[model samples]
Target: MYVVFFYQGLATHLSAKKSALEQLDGYRLRLRKSEEEFHHKEDERHVVAETLKKANAENSVKTAVESDGEEEDEEDADAGSEEDGSRGYTPSPTPAKSRAGSHVSPT
Candidate 1:
């Protein structure tokens, strides 16, 4: 009877230990899954951030190019106007050439 009781007690203790180990394993698995999810989220955030940065840089370059084109167009228009003005205006005769052999007569 004493031996039987001892054997039963030992069996019960082993069963309890098995249950505790199973619980610990389940907790470890949950922790590992949570860690994997965290890493995935971090990678996604990095990708999004990189994409936004690239888009902003592209937009800035486009804006700079457009502004430069506008400045060039304005300069071209100013040059054209200057050319037109030069072509349309004639210089007046110089005073010395106009009075080369002329004497003023009293009236």
Candidate 2:
């Protein structure tokens, strides 16, 4: 009778240990899945950040190019006006004035 009771107790203890191991395995699986999900989200965020950075850089370049084109057009317009003014503004030539720092010796 005593041996039988000992065997029965041992069986109960083994069953409890088995169930505990199963529970531990389930928790570990859940933790692994959550970690994988977290890493995946981080990767997605990194991709989004990189894409936005590229877009901003492209926009900045585009704006810079547009401003440069506008500057060129304004310069062209200014040059055209200067040309027109020069066409009507010929002045009479005057004799050269003597400079105080002149070093020319008469030939």
Candidate 3:
């Protein structure tokens, strides 16, 4: 009778151990899946961030080019106005005389 009770106890212990091992395996699988999802999301975020940086750089370059073009246009307009002299305004001769007078050495 005692031998039968010992055998039953051993069987029960083995069954419990097997159940615990299965639970541990299930938990490990869930953790691995969660980690994989997190990595995937991180990769996507990096890609988007890089894309945004590139777009911003391109926009800044375009803006700089446009600003330079505007400056050149304004310079051209000023030069054109000066050459045509259609505004009925004559430039003063005093500035040229002053520059020449300054070059004369005082004896």
Candidate 4:
């Protein structure tokens, strides 16, 4: 009778250990899945950051080109005005002075 009881107790203890090992395996699988998701998200974030950096660099170059074009236009306008001045083009008088002179009051 004692031998039978000992065998039953041993069986129960082995069964509990097997159940615990299965639970640990389930937890390890979930941990692996979570780690995989985390790595994928990190990779996506890195791609987005790189794309933004490339766009920023392109915009900086575009802005510099536009500024250079504006400077060239301003220089051309200044040169044109200087040419006009050298040709002795007299500026027109203001409308108020012209009207006052046109209406000379007889004193």
**Once superposed on the true structure, which residue ranges of model 1 sit more than 4 Å away at CA?**
85-107
27-46: candidate 3 lDDT, tens digit per residue: 99999999999999999999
Candidate 3 ranges beyond 4 A from true positions: 85-107
* Cα lDDT of model 4 by residue, 1-107, tens digit: 99999999999999999999999999999999999999999999999999999999999999999999999998887778788784434678776645545675799
Clashing pairs in 1: none
Best by lDDT: 2
* Tens digits of lDDT, candidate 2, 10-107: 99999999999999999999999999999999999999999999999999999999999999998887787788886434578997977877688998
Superposed model 2: Cα runs more than 4 Å off: 86-107
TM-score of 2: 0.73
Clashes found in each candidate (C-alpha, N, C closer than 3 A): 0, 0, 0, 0
Colliding pairs, model 3: none
- Residues 17-52, candidate 1: write the lDDT tens digits: 999999999999999999999999999999999999
Estimate the TM-score of every prediction.
0.69, 0.73, 0.72, 0.75
Best candidate according to TM-score: 4
lDDT agreement of model 3 with the native: 0.91
Q: Output the lDDT of residue 92, model 1.
A: 95
- Please give the distance, in angstroms, between residue 38's alpha carbon in candidate 4 and its true position after superposition: 0.4
